[model samples]
Target: MAKPNLPVFNSPEEQFQQLRKLIIERIIVLMDSNFSSLINLLYRADVDEFKLKKALAENPDNPAEIIADAYIQRQLQKIETRKKYRK
Candidate 1:
């Protein structure tokens, strides 16, 4: 039997992020096994949230959309923070 080896990263923070992403994927898979709608809605909400942020950055004059986007982004942040911390 041979021992397996993993690559080392110069930056621990970057390594942490890569590991975090893998964990999040495992979580989404688990969620899909049960609450599929929740998973889908979360995915769509994230995409919309990102688009809104980009729009706000690209067009600061759009007050209405900016406000809506800020609200959605905040809500998503809260949800994600809660979910991540709970795990």
Candidate 2:
């Protein structure tokens, strides 16, 4: 047997673009009532600001891989200093 060819994005940008489509596709599938509720019900979502933007921008059905929100949360948390949240 040979190794499978897993889809590997060229860079973070590519991943974000793809992620966005996935998020929106999932959202549509769920007929998401609200953003928070959608987030809560998602089995897993790679929710990044860029991805969210892209998802909301495109048809969303183009991409098929949706990374969990947990991943995005972790990425947003890794920093040397804290940042202020917008109100």
Candidate 3:
């Protein structure tokens, strides 16, 4: 039987780098899933998709800020609908 070959890291730093990369990739996947859910909620609430995308770009590094923007947008949409029907 032939032994399977696996690449070996030569130093602690190299192993750490590999582990860190894996962790970051997993985090990114989780973030994507959460963001998708947020977007869907915003859409169902009648929030503008363009505005949400702009907010995300404006706060590229802050997920909380993006979420706040989504919530605010939903509120604004609700207010607008109320005003429209009150006429």
Q: Which candidate is the best by TM-score?
A: 3
Residues 34-77 of candidate 3 have per-residue lDDT tens digits of 76765565567776778767877887886554655466557767
**Candidate 1 residue-wise lDDT, 1-87, digit = tens:** 233343677898777556545544544554447566544554655546566568768887753445344445656688989999999
Higher lDDT: candidate 2 or 3? 3
TM-score of 3: 0.45
Where does candidate 3 stray beyond 4 Å?
A: 1-36
Tens-place lDDT per residue, model 2, 1-87, is 233344689998887767665654665555544566665554343346576557646644533333344344545664322454431
lDDT per prediction? Answer: 0.56, 0.52, 0.62
Reference-based TM-score of each model:
0.32, 0.35, 0.45
- Clashing pairs for model 3 are none
By summed lDDT, which 10 consecutive residues of candidate 1 come out lowest?
A: 62-71
